[model samples]
Target chain A: MSANKSILVCRCAERGLVDTDGIAGGESVLVIPDLCRAVADGDPMLGGAFSEVHACHPRAVQSLFRFAGHPLPDTTQVIDCRCDGAGHAALGTMEDKPPAWYPVIDYDRCSSCGQCLEFCLFGVYEKAPDGRIRVVNPDQCKNNCPACARICPEAAIIFPKSVEVPINGAEIDDEAAVRANIRVNVDEILGDDVYAALRARKQKRKALLNRKKIERALEERRKCSGGDQ
Target chain B: MKMEKTGVHGIPSTLQERDSLRLRVETYADQQGLVPPLSMEELRDHALELAPSSVSVDYVMVLLNNAVWRETVASIPYERRLLLLPQCLRDFKNCPAEMDEFGLLCEECGRCNIGELQSLAEDLGYVVLVAEGSTVVTRLLDGGKVDAVIGVSCLNALEKSFPHMADGAIPGLAIPLNAGGCIDTTTDVEHVRNAIRLRSDASWVNQVDTARIREMVEGWFSAIEIDSMDTRTEQIAYEWVCGEGKRWRPYLLACTYDALSGADGIFPEKVRRLALAVECFHKASLIHDDIEDDDEVRYNAPTLHCQYGIPVALNAGDFLVGEGYRLIASVPSRTADLMRIAVENHRMLCVGQGEELRGLVDTPPFTAAQLIEIFRRKTAPAFGAALRLGALAAGGDDRLDAALRRFSESLGIAYQIHDDLEEYRSGEEHDLRASILLALANDQRPLEWYAPDSPNLDHVFREMMVEEKAAQLLEHYKNEAIRALNPLASAPLKSLLRRTTSKMLTPAGGRA
Candidate 1:
């Protein structure tokens, strides 16, 4: 996309929105700082400059545009610039993803003590309209804070293992190395029994994943064959 | 012929049936006010009285005996409690493990859960014996080395051991193995662990009624209650403060005080005021923060500023700040010390808040470390103030104050990171200035991910990379907070703080 067609506004003044100096059409990419305030102040010239405005919160930016009294261009696209600098560069290629981790309540074990609901400062767990306590906002849960689980008398709450994403070009080997280190640490601290159990659990998980992969492949093949028929 | 349902040794087969039997036995024991050392006949009589005529009298008797002794067994110190595991629990076929005079020495091969159970029980200071038969247990009790026994045995073995336990007057908890095979049997490890870890000392956790404390704090804000304390400004401040909140700040203060000074006695009046002071500071900060952030709502209600306008809200916030200082000054003991600590924390909080406001003027792509640093500045001091004031109210020294500062800093940073993750998941408007997720993605992901024409930035938020990194940091800080308690001499305080750390961070089914 031509730089003139896109405006990159950095709400953060500390770092320039992007290192625009290196790009071919980088100069045309307007790097406006404190864009929220600028838009809130009804900067008339701001809206006429670009067809598309890229900023951290697109919804907020759109509101600002409306407040500024500038009619949005027909081709206007308010790109959400909430992601980090690296994410901004690769936004289009990214796919919809599941939550990295969340709490899963074992109904059988839960006594409906409501301790979790009371304990969580964040509105993560809530009383449902039906009056049952539920994980109403799984996303609001602090991925690592299992405070509610610890306080739970019946030990009903469980969280999924956090997803590990490869950083930079770190291959699967790097991930394996990290896991190996963790295993060694666990063995040293919790003894070989825990280590063995963890290894067995991991192996089981791998087997399940492999089976799912095979099933998906078979399903795809069947679909193709059915289409031909 | 119809097969009769039975457990390992003719107990109830299903868990529900077993639990029902145990509950009945316990109710009978409770009604009788029975303690341990009841004669076999006495236990049998009580069990028979509670049990239905169709139910086995022997099974009910054993259940009643176990129930009566549980509390006494729990009251015994770990050093005096013996963990007796049946040798049959081992994977005897695969076992290369050796045995001494005491019993089997687990090789920790992990074929069965024996090794894990042994290691954990030993770590908790229990003299774990991986042997069977009642003779050894009775001999240990006769020697007076063991006051209580948490025994894992088959139903037959548990029955055999009961007469010996009753003879010795030893408080014991019996966990009947799931099956009766002599070579290898299974028992619930969690049940055993819970038995071993049980202590009457930790009953203080249940004693502190958080609901009651919250009610008392809420009472402090009532118009009639504050009528004598102050008139005009106090009433206005109470109007804003009386709004619904989790009241975590005051709760933390009260918990800390109760931890330091046992909850058995009356709560100190000065500590109560100090807790109220912490809330005042918290409420004041919220009012100012709302106006600064231009937030319209708080606690599902209109913010102080939005309700009464900025000028009135600002005055009310200022009044709260003054009231906080007044409350601290009113503390009967260590008035100067309390004042100094409060001022220091207040200034630190302001500096942190100022930096945050400054950052908004020119938003930066902050790194995770930078975001954490901001968190420490903004959040840590508030927690520190509450903790230190509680300590100070309880006649704590400088050493305790120093430790609390470190603990609060780690806790505060972790807490803020937790909030960030929460906000990210809620799909709320991103506050880019101090977002660890944004910082992490910027640092870790490739530059292409931030392209102007990138279709969806949603992937960045969903990427496990940032969340995982933040989780690791959260764990690190949580451990740091726990570690800070090492210098603490009071076991109860240390334990309470440790539990608090767990309550804050432990996810359901997460590691203990």
Candidate 2:
């Protein structure tokens, strides 16, 4: 049954790293590390593995398939899932997780107008069981879709600064060895004094970052203690 | 007067007509010493005086555009010049390129002259756009990034953009596309190159023939000469060094030294050694880089590691690097200062490379800014070192040293960004290892497109946007490099450095 279903390949879902969640249950979703590599290798068996393959970037997929030595199967579909909310259901997840931006209502300035609820098409808002409008599905709120915020007549809505989500589980391989190689290579090409100067600049940057971190922590502590009063 | 010289679309267009018009304009300028910022009425009168009865209004408009802009274009800095090319210049059938909001993303496959023109203009620090009509011209004018324009388009599009240029008071020279079907059109390539190199000091054009410098540098690595030292390693090193490459680094070194000393002849002996040393270092880096990246080919030949095996290649690379240092040490003038520059830049280069390698294991979603920072660190230092070595060889003072460092850093980053754009256009491979396009795509595109296992995306709009941003950044850095030259008192050296900045971006055979 899963083999008969269409599998959507959303490339931007995880910064082109990996998206295991797109493999829903037993659905025949194949996650290739790189389309160019897959097409270059041209595994003939791939042509018949799935009923349909929908990709966010169809042109690239088509080019890759062509490069792979065969035309994309008739069942292949390319969708415009960039930011227009198309083919999102098949992809099974939104691109930006932990949603970098969401609407926040200011109760003090609010006149309790329901304009935001009407304007939002993504079901990001709902009438609560208690009959008051509230943010029920914040995850459904598209990243940087500020239409609802703009349409708010009361001007009570605000979006916080977008947080830069660090890539998870990413680690530099043998940082010290890499650095040592760099030093050795540089010393060989330039000379020892150049290495010393580079080191000094690096140390200065590190010290500045450390100082900033300490200052931020101290400010946070001060705010926390001040709020206690 | 019959309109005998008409185009396919009945527009009065012919090569002879255009040439005669250009000849008259040049004659007028020569006779009258007419610089740009001329009134439209004055330009019209001049055109009428040249060809009162036969020339069409379109030809007059073009002549006017040239007359009103030539001197202004010459005076404006190269970084402030924009080359507006029409999409029709592209090979319609063979081009696997796409259009963005700003313009066409040229693949630069050399299928058409657009690639050559774009490459040349960009090398000269000109912002090149492959789009027709007035839209981008108006935007570029309003943005204030471009001070002058050299546009190639049909008469229709040129007329459309004329009002916008006039209103903005922007100096512009328009070269009408040779054909008028708006697809697969051609332009006089020689004329375009001449306009691009039209600076106030025409004598500066081809002042340092890079080909000559390359030939001279090649002699330094002669196998016979190197083998005379009686060592197998020296022979191998010489062979590796003498292999086919652009030799841009050595050229930069020699150019800088010449600019500083105001010497118009072959580099003196010490400067030659210094220039050769710069190449040795660059070639050595390539060898080790190939091994690290596991690349098989370079300059269309087997990489050092691939040819000689990793151990021997590594040793050879190390030996070349040592030779670079030795060469610098052997320079007669201010060897200590030269060594300092070489060592410092080498370290910076390593740190930059280390940062890049470190990124591989975790493969962080680097932003464009971060990638630019890496470019600055890794690529800029080599250029800086080459420039400083040349400067020091010419007996440059501390002030020049500081200026060269700043200038090279900016030039280096801009150069790398330009390379990234070129690589993206070539579509040879989808290697986004250190690509600014990928960084911008990651930062701007929706989350779903960021998946590690995702297919290569061809979002033309995003690519164009990123390219626009990168061009702005490139312009910013180019200006910074120019600014760094402000401290220098010597006018020739200043002009030479400016010309060098232009030369650095240009590929071989880019100039006329």
lDDT to native, each model: 0.64, 0.63
- Give the TM-score (vs. native) of candidate 2: 0.43
**lDDT for B303 (candidate 1):** 94
Chain B TM (all candidates): 0.61, 0.59
Per-residue lDDT of candidate 1, residues A109-177 (tens digit): 567767667545456788776766676665565433444554455545554221122111112245344
Report the C-alpha lDDT of model 1 over B1-512, residue by residue, as the tens digit: 11122345456666777778777778877886664455565667677677776566766776787787676566667765667787767775677665433346566668888878877876777666676344344445432234567888766656566665654455678887766545566766777778778888633221334457667666655633546655676677886776777777777787777767766435777877888788889999999999999999888989988888999899999998998999888887889999999999899899888877775564445666666777888999978898888888877899999999999999888777777776666667354446777777777753332333344556665664677787778778876776676567554455446555655654433322
lDDT string for model 2 (B1-512, tens) is: 01122253423366676677677767776677554334344456666676646555666757766864566578777776778788767766688664433446666778999888887887777767775334444445432234578988777666556655543445678887666544566778888888888889543321344456667666665533665767888878878888787777777778777666767656788987887888889989999899999999988888888878999999999999999999888876677778888899888899899888886665556777777888888999878887788878888888888988898888888788777776666665366757777777667753333443345365643555876776677777766776676566554455456656655554333211
